[model samples]
Target chain A: MNTKTFETENQLIRAAQAGDQQALRELVEQYSDTVYKFAFKVCRSEDDAEDTLQDAFLNILKALKTFNHRSNFSTWVYRIVSNSCLMKWRKEKRERWESFERLDNPEERIQDSYTHWPDSPAEALLSNELQEKMDEAILDLPPIYRLAFVMKDLEGLKMEQVAQALEISLPAAKARLRRARLFLRDRLEPYVQS
Target chain B: MADELKERILNICSELGEDIDSADCKKLRQHVASCQDSSAFVDSVKKTISLYKAYGPNIDHDTSSRLLGKLGLD
Candidate 1:
């Protein structure tokens, strides 16, 4: 839990529940960057991320009155965002599975994200170099491992948050992260030497 | 490239609990300070950190406004 929520967050929660739109807006705005990032990362598409973002807060707002203020607002929102994003991910995964005919041939369908960072970063060359290596490394991870690594390492979430978000146990989170790191290390070894 | 060292660092990254211990933070800091000693190793570390820093969306105000609007907060 962050300090902002620790000290007198109940006031804001009350304000939000009482129909203070700005309070709700402040809360959403503060967390939206992270939310949007996560949505985009999971969906790998702007349209989907946009939809995920809208869907998340709309869900939150609809249930705002009944929301227990005991948990941190950030945690609550992370729960919402993660649920929505994972649902989208599951949908996509399902689509891919259907297309693959079965799960055994996933390697043939794996998206090789070459040149992903070239157009996505402030400094083109460095971004391209790092992202090329990084994407290859991350894409090499298994489904569970990639999700854990992305949630913890990429999104700066705590292990507890990752476990909570993914609805898995803490030890499960740790194992996946370990798997991701080993996968990345192997993928990155040659590039790091260059 | 000992499997053990790689396993250890990966464990550190994996065990990123909500409350990071001060000792863990200190160890990370120490590693950071010496990261530049080897280009390859530094690059390896940089790949992960840079990837983490790079994960967010490059969204615009138009999209933001639309999202906010849909949330009824615009």
Candidate 2:
């Protein structure tokens, strides 16, 4: 949390922008945590999150020369990370969802695996019944709604940032959030009273 | 009665806002109140939060070290 660390980071970015190899590597080390977490929030698995992190950093490295200084580094990096995650999700969908129906309610096709991360044991141990029920609730949500829930509710991203990352209009993002909340309320009715 | 409770829940959500542990939710303690339904509510809410805490990539501390080793920072 030192000011010095941040200052050093800013300087390193400037150097990395100019193609300094070491600085670029340092930048990767510094922000990869954010990239991985973002991916995991969406992907909900360790292996996928790890793949997304490495791919994001690699993409950033490839695209560094075109890096614009006008944007916040965090935001720009998020764009790259978000794109990577989306692509990965799309790939997974293609593999598993070729014959799947796209429901307007968005809850019809919720992925059961969204609730449980295969690699996380603690998530498994947190109250076995609760975890299972939670997973079912998440899966009950539609993809857009689930993504909105994960992005805004869980990842703590603002509406605007989420819209940018998802490449959607602000209103669309808000609508999705509403749907996500409504859907969760429906499924949670049996479980929560107060 | 059910509708009233639902309204209260939604109002609590609106007043407290969304993050499972928002300042308002924490301050009011309404969402996680000690009640039959409240327990289940908290349990489910926590499942979401715990998904991030446990499965989120930052939980992978070994990543930084392993990444450092790969990049020769180690």
Candidate 3:
């Protein structure tokens, strides 16, 4: 949600909790696209994103009464959506940190030797090719790291709020964000240079 | 860059958290100015994030409506 809408979010929450269907609809309408976009970015599959969107909203409605406002509403919703994504893929092993070994050695690419992109990010338009690379890089991250990266870097959440949403320590959230960022930077190196 | 310096640069880049001009990032800004590799690495990381941010996909109207319908809010 935008900052202006968030200024009045508490009032909407209070009304929704009081069984006000209109207030509840307002919340759903405002957050549905945000939730779905986050899910799609993290899940990377439209089908999975849709399923997560439904599950997250249902969970949010069920748990709304107990929401004590400790974390802001968007953070709470992110938590629910993250949990829904995690649950869907719990049986899979997602910790793939070892795959990052190839990109770990920044020492090899010294100051003069660093790969320079042909253009700055601002000058570069969003080509379909770069978009695919971005999607592929994000998908390559482990789910835990993906969640932290998405919430902080992509969704523009604060570090503390990201920790709250992911149920991890502040430092742990920072670590995940770091690894995810470096992993992506390395993945896009060749494409940007090319 | 040494391992220690590289680690420090990466940490500073990630923890800067989109607020490059914040007071906390003063040391990072200074370091990037002096160090070419760190600057490139930091710039690339920021670019990676900016690219993703620029290309963010929105939930189509029909999909969002279906979600609301499933929740009985439609």
Clashing pairs in 1: none
Model 3, A124-150: lDDT tens digits are 665656655666676666688889888
Evaluated at residue A154, the lDDT of candidate 2 is 71
Question: Per-residue CA lDDT of candidate 3, range B1-74, in tens?
Answer: 45466567668755774343456665766756777766665666667777766644567889888988998888
Q: Looking at the true structure's interface, with contacts defined as alpha carbon pairs within 8 Å between chains A and B, what fraction does model 1 recover?
A: 0.49
Better of 1 and 3 by DockQ: 3
lDDT of 2: 0.61
TM-score of each: 0.69, 0.65, 0.80
Q: Which stretches in model 3 have alpha-carbon errors above 4 Å?
A: A1-7, A91-124, A192-194, B1-4, B14-21
**Residue A49 lDDT, candidate 1, scale 0-100:** 68
Model 3 DockQ vs. reference: 0.47
- Expressed as tens digits, the lDDT of each residue in A1-194 for candidate 1 is 23244255677778888898777886677667777777666555567668888888788788779878776666677677777756666766644434222223424435533433325445454545666555544444445566666676677777887787677898887877666655665665655454
Descending-lDDT candidate ranking: 3, 1, 2
The numbered model that scores best in TM-score is: 3
lDDT of 2 by residue, A18-50 (tens): 877677667877687777777666665566667
Cα deviation of B15 in candidate 2 (Å)?
Answer: 13
